[model samples]
Every structure is written in C-alpha cells, then in structure tokens.
Target: MSDSREVVRGLLRPQFREATPYGAPQLDVAVALNTNENPFELPLEVAEAVAGALREQVPHLNRYPDREFTGLRKALAAYLQAQTGLSLPIESLWAANGSNEVLQHIMMAFGGPGRSALGFVPSYSMHELISVATGTQWIAGRRDEHFDLTAADARAQVQEHDPDIVFLCTPNNPSGTALGVDVIEAVLAASRGIVVVDEAYVEFVRPGTPSALALLGGQPRLIVSRTMSKAFAFAGARLGYLAADPAVIDGLRIVRLPYHLSSLTQAAARAALEHSDALLANVEELKSQRDRIVEGIASLGLTPVPSDANFVLFGGLSDAPATWQALLEHGVLVRDVGIPGHLRVTAGTEAETTAFLNALAAVQR
Candidate 1:
C-alpha cells in the first residue's frame, strides 16, 4: 500500500475534504438520550406482524421488489389520511431508506452544480450537509433570538438567497420549536424553487400546530418530508417519505435507484402501517415524559426551550461539554449540539426521565 491516507485524500471531492460525517455520538451508557429515538420498543403485536410479513417475503426474494413500491405507497397514503385527515392521492407520495435520502433525492433533482439551498440556522444540520453532498451551495439563514423564524424574517432570507431549494424544519431539531402555517406560506410565496418542510417530529407537536401538508395541495413546489423513526419507533427500519405534487414524485423517480425499497422493507413498513394505531399508542405517554423533562429542567433553574418534539433543549450550563461528561459519569448521556451553554436530551420512559433529571440536578449542584 502506497500511502493510503494520501491516496484517499487526493481522490476525495474538494468540498468534502474538510467535512465531518453527520451523526450524534453513539455511546454505551446506562441512559442514551443523544439521538431522538423512540424509547419504546415495537409492541409484541406489531413485532409479530412484522415478522409474519417478512416471512412471507422470503419465498419471493428471488424477484426484485416492486419498482414503484405501490403497496407501500398506498399504505402510507392511507396512514396519513387516518392520522392527519389529508386525503392524499398515492401518486403524491414518495419514500426511500430515510427522510435523509428522500431529501437527497430532492436535491439531486432540483439542486446541484451552480444551484443553492437555504435553511435557518440551528435547525436540522442534515439539510446543509445533503445540499453540499449534492454539490449545491448552502446558505445559512437566520432565526429569532428564541430560535423561532418569523414570516417576515423567512421571506427576507428567501429573497436574499433565492436558492434552488428551501428547507423548513417544523418542531425544528436542537431547538424543538414548531413553525406556523403563515411562515410556510410566506416562504412558499417568496421562493420560486422547491421548498421542503421537514416534519420529522410532527407527531409530537402540541395541539393547534398544523402540518405544512395543509398547504401542499395548491403549491406544486412544496414538499413535506416525514419519518417513522421518532413516533412509530421505527428508526432501524429507515423508512422516510415525503408528500408533494404528483409531478414532484415524477421528478424523484428520475433520480432514485430502480426498486430502491427491498421486499422485506416494503412488507415490514406495510405491516407497521396496518398497525399504526398500536405503534402510536405510546406517543401521548412519550409527550408526557417530554413535558416532564421540560418542567423538571426548568425547575432546576436551567432555561429550556418550549418544545413540540419529543426532546428538550436546555441551556444555563457553565460548560456544556463538561456537563455532558458529568451526566455520562452519572449513567446519563445527552447531546451537546455544539451550541454553547446548551444540551439536548430525548424523552425516555418515566423512570429514565427521572434518572436524567436527578443526574442533571446533581450535576448542577
């Protein structure tokens, strides 16, 4: 081997030469709350159903999966209708390995060399990373002091950047604040390109927070991406999807690999969708735990942002990295999102929440 490191560096894309991979720390700890995974495992009933569905597919493994993933799309459409009462046509849906990939496909179609993407800061980091990976220029926008984006502010940024794609994250990551419908409309009006509303955590939004899906009917350029990772507790399955105009679906088809979804994946996702009610039974309880975390953290004299997602982001630490290490020492792990004085923790089972709170309190003292 002739200097493997140098050879790899020479072959790597210039833009990616200095980039780090996107991920939260995966550590073995008594409590792992870094990534916002659903704390509950699949219920026995759903697990059995998934198993049965997968078993049925083994006999047909010789054949490639449905190139269109028709059944999976229909099931997803049905689930969305039941959950959000949005009567979306199956043609309006698209899915891939995860919402990240779904977003990547969007960038492939609409963003690339000489194009650009825009997202507000402290939102989902993946938006920018995916854009850069697609050779699209990334523009960082602004949010208010409290991490909320106003319609006027959003429109101003859109006008200034005029990117080929705009990413708006509802119940935005790291901050956990949901956007208003007005903000979505304003951004749509301001942008001539595809606008992606990332609702990855929408299932946990507080009442009165409407989904951007409501605005999808008239706006052909609008795309709302969601995932089963958080609420359905299906992160390992890696099924992320988006809803948009049928024309947008047609565009995604051009970029996706043929039969991108495996037979097992399609079958398992369909099975899970069939039992969505059962899988989602834990949502309210998880929301309760999330609220408990917010209140508990606030009671400890830390500043916690109001959340519509399953995690809480709190500040007031003397040193966030030191606090993260201290919490890990006490058998708890939370995220230090490179935001000074801030840390994010997922809502776990009640006992886990209590343990985290107690650990945080002890560290504070």
Candidate 2:
C-alpha cells in the first residue's frame, strides 16, 4: 500500500493551492496602507480593559473556554444594536476566529459540490477563493463600466446561476464603489439562495449608506457579516461576526470548531467593543483622511474612485506592481491590485497621506 502521507497528498483538493496572493506588504515606511486596516491603535482604556480581562482569567488558561462564547457574543450583539441601529440580539449573532472564518463557515454550510456561489467581478477575491475551496462553482458577474451593478444585471445573474450563496462586499473592495441598498434588496428579492452582505468597510462610509443589516430581520435568507479589522483597528485581534436569522446562525454553528475563539481573543474583542466610541472617532478621522487623499490623487490628474471606505482606488497606474514597488522604494507601501491600470491606497494619518503624495509625485518624476 502507498504511504499515508502520499495518500493524503493525492487526496487533497486541487483548489487548495489555487489561491490568489493576498497579504499586507511589510516595508519600512512611516505611513503604510497596503491593507485596509485602521491606521490607529486601540484606545488606551480599551487596551487596559483587555489586559484586565486577560489577567483576571489567567488562572483559567488550563480550562477550556465556554464553547459558545456567550459573553463576547452578547457584547457584540449590543454593539451592533448601537452601531447599525438594528436590533440584533445575541441569538441572531455568531462569531468565528475572524470574519474570514465566518465566511468560510457560511460556504461550508450552504455551498458545496453541486451548489454555486455568486459574486460581482472585481469584488473581494476571497469570496471566489472560498467558494472554490468548498467545492462549489464561483461565478462572477461583471459590473457596468462605471463600476456599478445594475438592478437588472443582479436579477439576471441570480436567475441564471441561482447560486446557493451570494457574497457582496459593501464599498466593494478594490473598486471603492458602494452598492445601493435598494439595488441589494432587489437582488435579495430575486435570489432564492442565501445572500451574504459583507460590511467590513461600512463604518468608513458616510452615515445612512444603508447597511445590509437594515434589511436583516425582514429577510430570513439574508446575512450581514462585519469585521472589527478595519475601522475598529483590531486586525491583529482577528474578530468578526454575523447577524442573521436564528436558522442561519444554527447552520454556521454546525461547521465551526468547538471553542473556535480563544479566551484571550474573546476578551480582546469584548474590550474593543466596549470602546466603540473611541474606535469610531478614529473612523471619522479616516474619513477625513480619505477625502484628502482622494483630492490629492485627483490633483495629480489621476482618476480616483469616489470611495466611502478607508481606501481610495485610482486608475492611470498601468503597471500596478511596478508602481507599487516604486512607491515602496521611496519608503511608502500601497496595495497593487492585479487589475490592469488600477491601484488602491489606504487613507493613513494626515502626515502619512502627505508622505504618500510626495512619494507618488517622485515616482511620476
């Protein structure tokens, strides 16, 4: 018989290694915006609270954490209530090691071999990658030339593929376009399958952008996923949650590992939630920075996509990686999306934005 390792290797799914490259760039720069992370730190009070929680639970490290994460879940539910103006009770909420895992769980529970997952072209690539990993077909519908999805296009795709799941990233990544809620509702009405609205960057958008959570209770098949990674400055903490119907939450729970979140992770996230005010203050600042960065990019005669998120995507940089590398050479790092003639820059602090502009001009020279 063949060796166990050899057998396992042969059995591994072909899609396992077919992932798109995604990770933050590490460069020695005063302002780094390669990833869509908040360019701020957790508030002092929240950090202290997290430390306190960890110290209080230090003696219990030997014991397994509460498998259900009841406390952190409740805090998250409350925070969502205040943030989204949606009455998301703890029963309607579920957490994973991160929102990334939450989406994976969704794919596992609702998508597989015969089923398919649908998303818009040039949206977050992770959605496509996750669908492939689940042995599901990943179908992408191209957006209009303006980088906008039409109501008719959405309905047509939903009717055609009739996917088991549809993933939409609000303030859609790499493009910086925010799909309207009315358009989203139209898609949901046409879709017979589950619809996941990823609101990872919603906080950075202007108020009243109409989050998918607003339509949550009314639509049983709708799930709104959020992460504390961007506006909340908790990327390293790796926390994200979902607000959905009880049935959907139950489905997610089926695929999750017991104690998927460590006690420390739960504590850190809870502390961050407790200081949402401070975190959101930082969000407001990022919005300001986004405006300034967009203006600066426009001043350079580049076309900057109108972004309601923490990052701005611009066209005119035909060779994105080379442009990105040039910026890096000048001690500034930005994201170089694979799309032709496109580049994205996160809005850092005021000084960082200026530095990036200077570096950009220098590269052009």
The most accurate candidate by lDDT is: 1
Can you list the residue pairs that collide in candidate 2?
A: none
Q: After superposition, how far is residue 33 of candidate 2 from its true place, in Å?
A: 1.0
Worst 10 residues of 2 by lDDT: 16-25
In model 1, where do residues sit more than 4 Å from their true spots? none
Which digits, one per residue and each the tens of the lDDT, describe model 2 over residues 1-365?
Answer: 45886776677776653434556667677678888878887778888987998887888899888888889989988887787667777888888877889999999999999999999988888898788888889998778876788778888888888888888888899877888887788889899899999888888887667788878867989998989888888888899888899989889888888879888888888888888888788878899989998898888878898998899989887677788888888888888777787789999988888899999988876
Off by over 4 Å in 2: 1-11, 17-21
TM-score of each: 0.99, 0.94
Error of 1 at 329 (Å): 0.5
Number of backbone collisions per candidate, in order?
A: 0, 0
